[model samples]
Target: MKINYPDGRIFNSQPSKSSLHTTNAKKKLIFGDRGMTLEEEINESNKYYRAHDIAVIYKKPTPIQIVKVDYPKRSKAVIREAYFRQASTTDYNGVYNGYYVDFEAKETKNKNTFPLKNFHQHQIDHLKMCQKQGGICFVIIKYVELKRYFVMPADEIFIHWDAQFDGAKSIQLKDIEKGSIEIKADYNPTLPYINAVQQLIESGKEKK
Candidate 1:
């Protein structure tokens, strides 16, 4: 199936963020042995959370605008054309321990930096707004080359986003190490990110 926007542009496919996705005649990403993409790992973790009553997080589904459909059979209809109904905000959002948790997940092959270009201005703005309303907002960045994960607070992301105007196009790994909580990719809950969320909540209290 293919989807195209009304403006004559194809909107069905997107670049793969998985470690298994090859690129530029080089090894693109890293997933060690599990071979799971960042999003897959997070989804598995979310399921674990829901089953144990730890958190109620979920991937936000993007609504599609249907443009064409074909009745291939009386019992079946095939969607031939569609587009995203609107620009979506974050990837996931829900309640965790009485606090609103909102975040985006990104994977990068860069070993020393996470490119700011991975994010859009609308996402930054949405996270900022969520943070303002007392939500635990952040980004979960997967460094595919290094096979590391970090839960970075939204404030750090804003700082780097604002600095892009001054020529900073990416956030340094060292800065992320300092300002974020690193979580090991583990079992049962593959990401174990909520622990980092607890850290963010505690760190916020310290700031107050």
Candidate 2:
């Protein structure tokens, strides 16, 4: 099957990795070609959770606007031209243990710090709204080169996001260690991030 766009372009099936991320990803030592992306890992785990009755989390699908389509067969159709509808606010959101769980997953190649540039202001604002509504909000960060995973609460993220304006471009590894819950990736559901979510819920109770 072949799709030729009216604009002399081929089918825009999926977004290329380079086009999806910032230009910094190309220059940085991301070491990402070796394994699954953070989004894929979380999605796989979400599937497992659904099957096992653990949680009902899912990756919110990005809405795509199809400008052109080609139907070579009666049942097969190819998108010749398409574009994303809007910037998605967060990655995964759902219910866990009677609580609303919302989070964004991010992976970085930096060894010293997780660059705040990886996040957007709208994502932060979405977390804020969820938190105010008593939702358990956080971010799952994966260090590509280090093979480390951490679930940092939305509050900690807000602190660093605001500080970026005052010269803090990233969150130090030590600070992340102190403020977040570490998750050891495993075999069953892959990354058992829901365990960290449990810890966050407990901590919220403690604070209250």
Candidate 3:
């Protein structure tokens, strides 16, 4: 299999396998290539949405300050020193169906829990602000080892986040299953998170 990037880069997908070279140890290892990372899948999904006029969402680019640069050649320049200007608010934000949408994408290898440390304080605060302003704020989390994905509302996430000070540093998988909507993976939009968003919207309306 081959994946072509927007920048015209082609990546060939190879079967990843490992073997133990011993007389007694003849175990065949199989590596699962779950296609793309959470970020890449979200980006591709956003692109598909934008192309189909469904929504306009994009990844927020982090601001960086380049202090030193060297012109290694006439055609190419090398960056020597650069620093982040500031922390970013969220991973993605835009408008969809006349409603503001804001979200962050995260992935964890742990199957039992999703750590609160994966998120920043400022990001949580930003999500809270967005929710207060009637924006649809949520988080897309992927459990790599389990091959599962979920879309959790920001308000629900805050409960577990605030509980961290009480010694709970992570949200248990069972808790996530109870609070979030599982997004089915696809090939066209990759993540198809909008389905989960629609479910969230309908649930909110029902609650009201």
Candidate 4:
């Protein structure tokens, strides 16, 4: 599949586009390519929203504590090693339709269920804080095996997460089926994520 950008550049994958970058920490390289990593797909979807003036969102760069740096030459200083400052929040967040939107994008190759371990405590805490601040918080879960995605509200997620203390390690597929808004892949903009956002906002409005 090839998508020709307005700049006359044809992209075979989402990562090949200008807006997304992946870091090869081992190689110490930041490279962009024209392929669809799950991250790249979501980034591209966000770009679509931005172009339509619908929303503004971006991935948060992981906070890292630099331990050592080597300057082999005058032009560039190489970061030799670093550790995460803390567990990261969601993949993206921004304002849309005068409302704050926050969400994490995750993909699972597993056929049965998405493991809760994919999400971190700090992420849950961040989402809770955002919810407290009157923002919309949700998770964009991709069942890669099925090529399907769903948008699940933070409230629903919290319930299951809280149950983990009672010995539930993961949420079942049936649970997600009942609680999430599923999204199908598309061609024009690839994943139609903004549609999921719209559904989430409308559902929130209905509740009030």
Q: How many clashes would you count in candidate 3?
A: 0
Clashes in each model (backbone N, CA, C under 3 Å)? Answer: 0, 0, 0, 5
Question: Candidate 4's residue-wise lDDT over 85-144, tens digit each?
Answer: 764677689988898999888878888777898888989999999999999899988887
Q: For candidate 2, give the lDDT.
A: 0.80
Residue 129: error of model 2 in Å? 0.9
- In candidate 2, what are the lDDT values of residues 91-206, reduced to their tens digit? 68999989999999999988978899899988999999999999999999999889999999999999999998799999999999999999987655768999999999998999
Model 1, runs deviating above 4 Å: 1-33, 71-76, 84-86
On the 0 to 100 scale, the lDDT of residue 46 in model 4 is: 68
Q: lDDT of all the models against the reference?
A: 0.81, 0.80, 0.78, 0.75
With a 3 Å backbone cut-off (N, CA, C), the pairs that clash in candidate 2 are none
Considering only N, C-alpha and C atoms within 3 Å, which residue pairs clash in candidate 3?
A: none
- What is the number of residue pairs that collide in model 1? 0
Q: Pick the candidate with the highest TM-score.
A: 1
Q: Each candidate: RMSD to true structure?
A: 8.8, 8.7, 7.5, 5.6
Worst 10 residues of 3 by lDDT: 10-19
Superior candidate under lDDT, 1 versus 2: 1
Model 1 Cα shift for residue 171 (angstroms): 0.9
Name the lDDT value of residue 173 in candidate 4. Answer: 84
